[model samples]
Target: MTQTENSQFRIECDSMGEKQIPSNVYYGIQTLRAIENFQISGLKPLETYVDACIYIKKATAIVNGELDCITPETSKAIVEAADEILAGQLRDQFVVDVYQAGAGTSHHMNVNEVLANRALEILGDEKGNYKRVNPNDHVNYGQSTNDVIPTAIRIGGLLALSRTLHPALDNAIAVLETKADEFQNIIKSGRTHLQDAVPVRLGESFRAWAQILSEHQNRIYVASGDLMVLGLGGSAAGTGMNTHPKYRDRVVEVISELINCPLQPAPHLMAAMQSMAPFVNVSGSLRNLAQDLVKISHDLRLMDSGPKTGLKEIQLPPVQPGSSIMPGKYNPVMAEMTSMVCFQVMGYDSAIALAAQAGQLELNVMMPLIAYNLIHSIEILGNTVAALTDKCIQGITANQERCLEYAEGSLALVTALNNHIGYLNAAAVAKESLATGKSLRQIVLEKELMTEAQLAEVLNLEQMSAIRPLGS
Candidate 1:
């Protein structure tokens, strides 16, 4: 199949049949079929995901060229074409719907076609000229969708984390730590079951959140360790069929240097190809992070609840108006948005879990779903954490007076009186204080449960709400 001069479309043929592809586009017949077959989601592949695929193509071209599997001229053209895509050219050529065919063969062919056609152009040949630079023979010389898609997902996940999520987590942890130090002296009442329970340092809350995020960061890193092991070179059902004997190790080495990330070939290629556990592990870690983020966001909203009616121990930066009808209300919009994104990540994780187990014998037909969901979770969670850090966490201010008032008025302070006055007497004093609308100190003094000096020593607000170090 070939394109004629002055034609709007090119005739491209495959084993199944032929289709007319737009002359201007690099993607060929298989990609066109995919575009027509699946219209679900309308979402395209993530840029990092595309880059991951292109990286594999570039590495494979270099390796195949050195191994004499493809001619030097053909390999050079393919490398140049892949470099162009990596430099952010021809992005629109990867137009396959994200929901398309099982095992991501449609998308894999789309990548191969784009690179093959672009290479043909570089070699002074017209598009659709498979004899000049074939998509299957030269571009995807030693790969199958089975091997390539999973490898792409691993690379894509690592790229997304390094470029977006990990840095976001670091910045968020730093911001929260700074806030913890800044608010270390402020005291506020702690609540259990939505009832006042004890006193706590305002800064300690931020410190706890920082620790939570820091721990989550570590867990995600641990889970991502599995991504570095490659099942690539396990072409066509993991038998290394038609692959060069040296291709597996050499390609992994090339990819590591190409992407600037350390990588290795799996000892048992079949197991690596068969198991979707790596993706499931990473997605589960992300879900774990999302759950903690929801808790932190809820805490922020509760602390910044109201100026006149609710607990006003902290104030979040009023980024936008809270209501359409209300004139002078500002909402914790940043934290609210963070919660929503985190919720979405949690949902994506669940989908990834289900898709991971749906894989049968040698390859997961559901790789495309896992790829999109896992990478999407990492990127969105990263972006949301960055926004939350910059807009809300950094701008938060503690209300010193309000914090002091809550710490002072909470009836839970009576718990500190137990050692001196006994539990029964302390309970009696708290009951009297509530019944007569008296202060805890006044009720205790009237009942003569302890001396003023003793009460003062036991009920020191500073001591009661001392800020503890993180992990203490």
Candidate 2:
């Protein structure tokens, strides 16, 4: 249809009043109100979240049909319409901003309206024909925005973690393990407080980082499991007044079968609806991932700082020209991007924490914001982890000669002379090395603190890197 043809509209009404809706679209009056009301964030709902909600509605319809709550034809239409949504069709029909009302009522209705109209179309009807396929009466059935929004958020979050975040993290771990093995022999000067401390294998640091990321992956998996305990059957205030007594368990079973996840009804409907701690827990795990990622990026930046002046221990692949005016200059662009993304994910975690705490008597009103922050944080961090692994970590090159040179020259090597020369004499040797610009071995030999053969044995690069290096 031409833009002018789509510009034609049909009338739709609700308790508030009536409005003209786009004649060619599936969404109806309430969704239109939401688009106008919550224009705060230009972001749309995550497609996974919208699909999760559709899955719930579809499961509800199937259960309702088996229970004789709705006719077989109505169930068939709703199921067919929802299947289209699950198949990734008409995804653009979800129009509410990620920033919306506390209960996410607008978004819940948005899904209902779209499904109702499309179901009508499947039954040989036109759009906005609510009398034949009502959004609230038929599409929403026994569900409320309070129950559906949070339930869908949990489902969507779990699906994304399983499909996107976990795999990316695994890829990162594998890449880091490869780098660790590749750099095992590259001994480098380890720094404490930005000052040289002692020798360490370059591969050891990468191995440590990989271990930290692996622990975070376990945390996210546990949190995602907590999300499986859902509050799907709890309508409005969680009293189970409008819904059939058996609807909750049956619908949960249907949904679990549909999504192939072991979803269960929350033990207490009111408590589950009011508390977002589960999501907060998941967000906290994501923040931990961001923390580790920030550390890794900073380490890369510091190690790759300068070819002439800085540590210059490793080289990150130059993905782009770093400076506009500096001739032939390259930057650690991936590390820089990773650091910025880490900061953003942490910020998102703060919003999720506060929103999780902002719930009141019966329902959390900040779900829209929470959903927005949670999904985006997971998605961006996953994408960054994959990018950092493939584009930077996998391709990094250790400056073995520079690392060995720095380790051999470091005044901290005087630590190896502690038993031979005594603490006081070893301190004197470190001071002499720094003062005279001579390597620790040269200073020790010149000061006659140890013989050349003793120095070689005590200050062996591999020996100094050990947890306990012999001094004598």
Best by TM-score: 1
Report the error of model 1 at residue 443, Å: 1.4
Candidate 1 has its poorest 10 consecutive residues by lDDT at 1-10
Tell me the TM-score of each prediction against the true structure.
Answer: 0.98, 0.95
TM-score of 2: 0.95
Per-candidate local distance difference test: 0.92, 0.88
Please give, for residues 324-358, the per-residue lDDT of candidate 1 as tens digits.
99899998899889899988998998898889889
lDDT of 2: 0.88
lDDT of 1: 0.92
RMSD of each: 1.4, 3.0
lDDT of 2 by residue, 1-472 (tens): 1123455888888899988887878898889998999898688889888878999999999988888777788888999999999998999899898888778898899999999999989999888877777889888888899899989888888777866788999999999999999998889998999999788999999989989999999988888888999898899988766888789999999989988998888999888888999989999999988998999899999999997888899999988998989988999999999999999999999999988888888888999888888888888898899899889998999999999988887788877789899999989878877788878788778878789999889988897885543874
Report the number of clashing residue pairs per model.
0, 1
lDDT minimum window of 10 residues, candidate 2 = 1-10
Candidate 2 clashing pairs? Answer: 102-365
Give the Å shift of residue 92 in candidate 2.
1.4
